[model samples]
Target: MTTPGARAEAGTTRFTVRSPRAEAVWLCLFAGEAETRHAMERSGSDWTITLPGDLSGTLYGYRAAGPWAPEEGCWFDPAKLLVDPYAVELDRRFVQSPLLATFGEDTGGIVPRAVVPAPLAPLPPEQPRFARGGLVYELNVRGFTMLHPDVPEALRGTVAALAHPAVLAHLSRLNVTAVELMPIVAWVDERHLPPLGLVNSWGYNPVAMMALDPGLCPGGVAELRRTVEALHAAGIGVVLDLVFNHSGESDVHGGILSLRGLDDAMYARAPEPDGRLINDTGCGNTLDFANPAVRRLAIDTMRHFVTHCGVDGFRFDLAPILARGPGFDPAAPIFAEIGADPLLADRVLIAEPWDIGPGGYQLGAFPPNWLEWNDRFRDDVRRFWKGDGSIGVLATRLAGSTDIFGPQRVGEGCRSINFIAAHDGFTLADMVAYAERHNWANGENNRDGHGENFSWNNGVEGPSNDAAIIAARRRDLKALLGTLFASAGTIMLTAGDEFGRTQQGNNNAYCQDNAIGWVDWNARDLALEEHVIALSAARAGNLRTFAQFPDPVVWQSRDGKAMTVEDWERPGADWLRCSAPGTGFGFTIDRAERSVNIDS
Candidate 1:
């Protein structure tokens, strides 16, 4: 295993090889025929290489010479120019080309290689300060800024665009404390994308955890750093939505781009009893956190982000998979290691809290100091506001879902990261405008996405010119936002949801990289934006009320009756007025001390 300090230099790149049975090995750089054969000496099981010249635009890969055997788990295909697991820059995106051969094929025992450019110099780190209660704006890089006409054309679709004055000004005006960027790491197009002429988006299929997606930062790390700095200057934190549960590599037949070539043992391969790679992640092989070496690799990847890229925090996708050790255990060593790391202890750590494996839905199981993506809160709120389910579930979720998140956590209020809609599912507009998921665009013939959406079209499906339906949808949207803000928890709003962004009814847009997912800043809905801004201000400006312990706020029905635990369980409760002292907004109720002093 490589030490943390080994590759901490500006331009140094490292690779590890495990050929205990081999005599010698060399690290080769493959840019083109002219510079294809430059070799570096190996020290022990590791090979270290520093480019001879400027490696920014240069393309390179590796060739390891070792014993050739298939059954012994040693398929040394020196002919294949393997990608460095720690590669920072990739020349071309991985496409399912015939160039990728099977492991058994020993035709010259080599495979075509993809060139990886040298790492850019690390950026100066920026540490952000997050107050206890603040609104988080979750956005996708390409989707958020790409269609904004106010931004410069060159800057669009890139990280630099996010720092553009227009973007920053909008975020500042929105009063958001942090911008939760959806997966900016290098990812791969799903196998179905090429045929449908679409691309894997939402960036959930990550190929590298530490490296930024070159597609999002053409100018490279320097550009990304500038963006982070700009956000920090605006008092806005940047948190990356990370997918560490699995790689772009699918199951056994998946691409051998990086990890598979470097070390398959680090990944959770199929158990030999059945010899099928664990498909816990539902995307591909689940990472084997059971291996101490793999755990170190994950930690190293996160450290690179903090020490090099200057990110504020990470929201782990399908985080329950990280704790699975043959079975789910919240006290897993990986969590313990991260919680104890001095550098990472203060950083924001969030978990998606579930995977496809058995017992994967461990919502409140995370240790203290970590926030969890509260899907129950999202679903119950949606259902209640849509008038589909019991308001009791909504009440519990609003009160911080104490049933899920135990009462012993350390956060001021709810450690729940509450949101009605996120990247993986429908946008806010579609949730109230479509009763069922419309995922035909994903090439799965509408078979993809969640079945129990708990959505309502309010008398019409898809687009409706009816004024009443439109008004109802808008009200429902506001109500959902209101519930999210009024509830006790950390609030996260999807980027375009503030202005009612829509995917034309497509709930699962993981494959639509086109305009379907992009936010149309040109067609701004002023009224909707104002509502969102007001709610954000209320949350940020009224921290005390939201932070109150035991009973933060009291809710009462319009009929002057205090809503009980039973009323919350009853369906069809359209609206409830909640009152709390020290809240920025003033309210009047029948009870004594009718006025609650607060600050806005």
Candidate 2:
């Protein structure tokens, strides 16, 4: 089947745009810097125009004339130009302006030229190589190599640098099976960031879902393919963390860059009782799956990566928003389609299965084959080790979280993606060094981040030179990672967490595109780093013990008696053992001393 966007067809080129709410659609072609506009003929929901010249190098944008009712979700204007949502490459980078949402605002000067790329050589099909009981490293492309002294200066911070032997050798030692990259898709900084001298360091706010961001891909998608090939050679797969719930275009008052300017129904808008765009993604707008075009874009973008880029899997950022129907329906077509899709059926699909909207906390509600990020495991593990809870909750998480993804559990290939820290929150060093979010540097008056972090500071709010505090911090850090490594199912470690990177206590470092967010290898704790490597190796060696029906975890009080029902949640005992004898593993949680001892 022919792909959706503009493509060379026969002797002529065909341009297509999807505008279900338009009265007319125009295809504007730019040749030799001079523009020509032609009315596109309609065929059902798609509008197409065929011309007699090779439009491969020619620049083009679409404009749709439709009803101008912002109240009822129709904001189509012929004066403003729109980018083809399926455009593979662009001549230049994209910039956002609030005037893009204004009616009759001609954006001829700033329209991003959609480049007609040369036909790509057929990519070799990738067989799924990722599975349970391996480490998944979350890395930021630019920040990862930006400060690295080993990576060549010319290739530093570029996608090609990931293929360098220096970086691969480092990852190989960590026993990483897959590198889950933060959003590398073309994204724009948040509207309010420019005035504060900040940029979207993390690529969560995306504009073009298909076009790889130039900041990450200086050598284009080919560099990404080369990096994937390199990782495959090293036995590591690539999993992209994608945000399909919202675009960089913020709220009603935000920029109308691509998706918002193309079609209003493409986004979900509530009708009455404070009529406005739904904020399911907490990013001001939630993409509407009620529109088939939105669903097509989500599915097709994933296929585009698999078909052209050779990605092994995808971790859907704020995934529940992509499955919304009245609310976040478990049986939404997006889930059903991917589950039944020939291309995606066997692929490794992960979900950040929640959003900021109604019924959004759907941790274990995803389909049978889809694995989910286990935040409960994260919180419970931290709380237990922090001496704030009992062995009950921690035992459940370590045993593959049967209560959440239960009834069938890991045997059905649905294992929790366990993690201690990720790109969003405090780093491993900051987690024990700071008790609260120190986001004053974010220019939001330290009021912009999460309130409850579930962290303990070992009697110090920030860094300390005291022998007792430092020793306690290191011990607690080892216990936390030891818990994640001992847990069943897949494991993920944030890029710098293994080495104890800190953000000066800043929990929401999303806006800081500087040293605070970059993974600084220079300030690493060598002992901690080696400790993490050991945990990863041990995790890799226990894959079979991790997948089972009757979970291997058994909870026992210090007296060696099996824990009673009352002991599971409310603990009167100060210490207990969490063990799986089949795996020759167990941990003694000593609440009195606030220490953990692993008994093999």
Candidate 3:
């Protein structure tokens, strides 16, 4: 239980924190532009101290002095220096300041300090190189190596430019089992994006929760443990995506940083003169995983990224506000304390489930050993390739959604992570070229992203020097990367959507940190990245029948018999198929010949 910030040891260096209504909490430190503070000692909802020698790379933070009463949540600003929700490292980045929401406003030069972190050792507990139906990808470590031309303009956009060997040969030519990233922690920049000069380039507005974002991980947890040991020596796997449902100290007029000045009941409020904090992650607040000290700072920030940066699991962001004790509990005691944590039981978790609160659309309601971000398989595979859906909802999202993850977990192999385009919408070349949401450079005039993006435009909407509308947007992006590699499960793709990367139609470029959030890598589309590396070598040669829902099944139509429930509700039926033939696997699709034809 002794795990809250600082640590160090062998020459003294303890620190701790967890305020539980601070009436005092000091420990400030710093030394460069000199500071000091000390005075901790609470022990009962922690405060501790120890100090003497080994203050490893020292630069600490935290101040706390209780009750300023953020309407009842209590933000106690000892002139706000806070940051250290077990901050694994942060000595900069987290700018936005009205002196971090003013009040006594010293802000120690506007926040960001917590560095201490020098104890290394730990990475032995193996098993999590990520496999579960392979191919996850996602990305955004500074928009995937900020326009990487083999990443070395001083390691272009950080996380050590994803262990670059041209980013591990483009994630080993997309046979990537798990990259996911998207929020290399330490975020901030969302107080309406610095009054629209804009900035949160998608680190999803975090703030410490296990640091690592000295501007996209500047060699921190040993540069993410040497890029997870060089993506486990190129067999891929990192994961992350994090945002434990909100922090970046946002809501009640935001900012006293780090768990909102060390515990505004670590967010999640409402009820009682409308105490008001729970925004359920439209990112304004919400992070009281029913507070067992916010699930022990989310299981010690997932065991400091699996014992100091091995990291092979966690996607979470707005994941039904971690089974909301404020409402949505598919038996959430933080999912049995992360399935009784042994460094998070076999890791891989994933979720992004849903959360504008209330029933918060919990797709398949998490915990069947997690993994779910199937925005109903991205709006029924973009409304069945934008021809207005149904070939029975694209054969229930090409066989695995099983009506929102049921039918015995889609015949025993599905938690459904399928994707039609992510990192929050539109690219797969702007969902076949932007039917809407251009975002007016996100000043919020085109009212920010996703306005029903079961998108379309194929005839010519955004960029087109018109070679037949860029060959019908690369033939609807090779029929949406051949219906996300003939569906089934754990799919995902996002990072430059296999070589097309266009935020030009800005599906909320998350405050476009320049070049509309990087990744141009010389205008990619090497024939749609060799058709997503031949659909990741045909889903790695049918990885266990694309990880489930393939077995003696048939489902045909277009005259090869079988299919009828009136050919999955006829209306211009388009065409269908689906074969399994005891795992030779299948596909076919057509949608009036925009084609997809996979067949293992």
Q: Each candidate: what lDDT?
A: 0.70, 0.80, 0.81
- Per-residue lDDT tens digits for candidate 3, residues 341-366, read 88898899888778887899888888
The local lDDT score (0 to 100) that residue 387 gets in candidate 3 is 81
lDDT of candidate 3 at residue 289, scale 0 to 100: 79
Model 2: per-residue Cα lDDT over 495-585, one tens digit each: 8888888888999888877888877879889999998887777656665555442354677987888888877767545677877666576
Alpha-carbon RMSD to native, per candidate: 4.3, 2.4, 20.8
lDDT of 1 by residue, 304-380 (tens): 67776687888898898888876899789998899788667778888888888999888888887788888888888
What residue pairs clash in candidate 3, if any at all? none
* lDDT comparison, 1 vs 2, better candidate: 2
TM-score of 2: 0.94
Model 3: residue 507 alpha-carbon error in angstroms:
32
Minimum summed lDDT over a 10-residue window in model 2 is located at 543-552
Backbone clashes in model 1, listed as residue pairs: 79-110, 79-111, 80-110, 80-111, 270-276, 270-277, 391-568, 392-568, 392-569
Native-referenced Cα lDDT, model 2: 0.80
Poorest lDDT segment (10 consecutive residues) of candidate 3 = 403-412
Off by over 4 Å in 1: 4-25, 31-35, 38-45, 48-58, 65-75, 103-127, 408-411, 547-552, 559-561, 564-575, 582-600
Cα shift from native, residue 401, model 3 (Å): 10
